[model samples]
Target chain A: MPKKHRLKRVFGAEERQHQTELLYNLTYAQSRRIGAVTVKITVEIADFKVTKDSDSVITTLNLGSCVGIALYDPNRKIAGLAHIMLPDSTNALDNSNPAKFADSALALMLQEMTKLGANKAALQAKIAGGAQMFFSPAGPASRIGQRNADTTSRLLRLYGIPILGQDVGLNYARTVELYSKDGSVVIKTAGRADKAI
Target chain B: MELFTLSDVHYEIMREIGNIGCGHAVSALSKMLNKKVGMKVPQVKLLEFGNVAGFVGGPENTIISIFIGISGEINGMILFLTEQPSARVLVNMVFGTPKNTELSFSEMELSAIQEIGNIMCSSYLSSFASLISKSISQSVPDMSIDMAGAILSVPAIEFGKIAEHVLFIESVFSTETDNVSGYFVLVPDLPSFKKIMSALGVD
Candidate 1:
């Protein structure tokens, strides 16, 4: 088991309780954040952020068929994110940006996460997005979302990273916020309750 | 993929195509609403696939969208978008739903709006098809109320897979009164874009 998931068990009850209290306190402030520093990964940008501070949150929006991945290293108290759009970059003729493909984005994000005191071997990932919005193009666009999800899963597995949770494949659009403190992924879909995956 | 470029003439042709197509659409809307609607000139441009949502409003703004997949001589997507309040007014006009309330639309209201969207898209397609002299048609309309980013991503991904850039036209639907307002977005595939440009003698 990853040491990050077992952090609460290893710590004493009082210390764990205190940490949970602090997190709970932050949660309320997170809702009505008057002055919080938020980094947003906009469409098509494969940006990664690593933070040791518990106060910062990383967010990505409009995840229709695109996938936003959150990887956390609990032992190092650091987290990273990548919003990848396409399943394969190898077939791309000119889109050379590493963040545009699952394979390349995962590779880049892992490198950056390790740079921030995260252990490559101890990383756990949570994913969201990859929905078939419409049954168009017969099979191409309709199936691309599933292919993106599969490609993402295949690459993550290839690196030996364990997936902690996922909320994917639906017609609704989603916006994702990854909390740095506990690596919780908050997914918001319109007219639907928020999910923490 | 070779970089797709549009010249000044090609750009103007696209704008005209947008104007003619959406003019028919808004006329259909005006007749439906029994209100005199006004519009701003269509804005046409080539955009990066990632930036398509920004063209609508933003990613997170909650809005109602109607999507139609166009395929005939040219292939692309046509989207009709409006804020919830605007949609409420439209629904009220169509289905006699109560106004100034927070109540969601009933199934009848949803289908009424869908039918309205179907008429508007058909008019838009017919106008453009006549102008280009191409046999253009549309798929069934898909309606949803969600984030703009999610809705726009359909065409963005379609265009992104083949090329990093896509061409879209943005047209505003509005009036002197605040009762009705919305946006009509057109995204044409690369081959169709080329075909139109070639038809207009813009090599």
Candidate 2:
């Protein structure tokens, strides 16, 4: 059986259609051909991806209170991006996905990068998102954006990974892209100029 | 009890709750806009963290959202979301501007939108509270114009700390113009879910 037929059989018609739409938005494969090969990977909420492909561009979209951390080893041309929702995993009721928390996600991404021939000493980070999004009185549920940024910074410092650039602590959403080739991070927001950090 | 393990009966009850809540909200909106409003049947679903963004188009789709915190008998959040065009239409209706007038959410307009959301939420909560014989209050409404996924993440992260899945009571409301439609989502936490079920005399 063809691959498409097998996927349809497993996922059914509706799921297959949804997957196709996701693929179209994620890859833009036909329209975004840079040179002979260009790979695009989308990191959804509470997910992480690490790649050493020089032609790859990894992206995470609509980061509200959540933070997107991009770590790149310029020496090895390896890049890793993690979209984490919360500050810590210790208090999570379901801690199955390590990528959902700042503390564990950074550690996991670093480990993955090192496994793919990236040097820990040469890893640098670029971070974005962590917007407050909405206003609420001071409480445990408030300032989640600040907490996520603080936790991510603290963990990176402890890991000896310097944050080279960042765009955080605002009142809007952000879309982030990390390029593996040159270790550049771009931040995009609605009705605003794209910033390269 | 786990949210995903809820039975069909529980979902049916949830559907009724959504129906009543949205019915009240629609009337409130209709009164505010002085236009005829209609609502689709409410949908109650237990959704994974990742799929919640799909409800309002997609993760990257830009939208106008209002957030209100629920307290008192239960603790949770309510989100009101509408596309840019729909938001423009609603704002225009409020200001009696031409239907095609552009809206950049000026201070006056923002406050108007916030008030609209506040009234709609209060009506929905009032109906729900009365139905369950509970007293619930809502926080001041906060508004944001951003990507749907970003707006949704606020509630997703809050709920993620307590459960793997979110139980959402989703209702879509539209006006006679048909170009104006909005989504209202109610997300109750695990303990609150239990409280609600028991209050409704359901196990």
Candidate 3:
């Protein structure tokens, strides 16, 4: 039922036989529905991706305790995506990677988008991820998911970017894709309905 | 004994620590399952947080995991992970194959596996703490059937702020029939490794 559990199912012998076909179909469905050609650029943890190609889709996956922020400029048809791990860099010992923290990650995304001819004044943000995957009692990680989502919001506000939609701080892993063609973000989680934010 | 750049001797020290900790945990697991278990030498490495899941499978790979967080003089998380087949084998051994569904694990079956994880994590931390003469305790074990990437990212996000690279050790435990094989991943916070080295009085 859950996407994670579905992954486990594919490991079984009975399902293993058809797993490849199913996965292929699923991936094929993500990009092509008939004649539409879509190119995917994935953003990993602490990494950011920006695209100006109208048919480009930037995606980030497996956001458990991490946050994925997507920025789009409708006028310029440019999208930037960043998958950040930590909530803040204020007390962090190392702040070398601008895309590693929620605060600085927003800055990096904005800069990259601007470099790609996106107007800072016309940017809209959408975010997903930051789910506390497991329950922990002795805590340094209890509410990190919420904290990360919250921090991403504060930083986006500071940049004067209005977040159009968000799906965050739940108990499921979320994969988000930002399509530059329409400046729309599609959120996918296993066992739940897909959402367009 | 730098955080990311540990000398071979330091690696040896960390490996020994892993061996000691895993030894006790597997022994406890053996007692619970009433079977003999063997463990591989823990694989120790300073790895990028993003690639940790790629070691087991991909970020999208589904895994059944039991997680426990450690706190006190040191901090970290211990993960007990296995594929669906291994989980089914382990659960079948204890619960007699979940009469209704052969494909999925029930809540009760999941709880049993969580108990195993709780025991293993407790033994591992207690054994290591006593060995180093330091005080440490663990939180309640939490169970999840999720993506390996999603499961492993919790610790990375927790520790990534302090260190870009994580010091992790993974050991595989296998039984005679090979039904109960499990992967145990221990991730200690960067600063805690230094404490461990100093407490052990090893360079």
Give the winner by DockQ: 3
Report lDDT (CA) for all predictions.
0.76, 0.85, 0.81
**Model 1 alpha-carbon drift over 4 Å, by segment:** A1-46, A52-55, A137-140, B1-4, B48-51, B97-100
Task: Residues B1-203, candidate 3: write the lDDT tens digits.
Answer: 45756777778877887898889989998887788999888888777877878877788888888888888898888888888777777777776554433546678877887887788878888888998898887888888777788888887886687778766787788888756788878877777777888898865
Stretches of candidate 3 off by over 4 Å are A1-36, B98-101
Worst-scoring 10-residue span by lDDT in model 1 chain A: A34-43
Tens-digit lDDT string for candidate 2 (A91-120): 888888888999988888988999999999
Badly placed stretches (over 4 Å) of model 2 are A1-34, A138-141
Query: What TM-score, to 2 decimals, does candidate 3 have?
Result: 0.88
Candidate 1, position B49, lDDT: 56
Global CA lDDT of candidate 1, please?
0.76
TM-score of chain A of each: 0.76, 0.81, 0.80
True contacts kept of each: 0.53, 0.68, 0.71
Clash pairs, model 2 backbone: none
- The sequence of per-residue lDDT tens digits that candidate 2 reaches over residues B43-156 is 997777788889889888888888888888788888888887887788888888865657577888888888888888889989999999888877888888888888888888
DockQ of each: 0.39, 0.50, 0.55
Q: What's the candidate order when arranged by decreasing lDDT?
A: 2, 3, 1
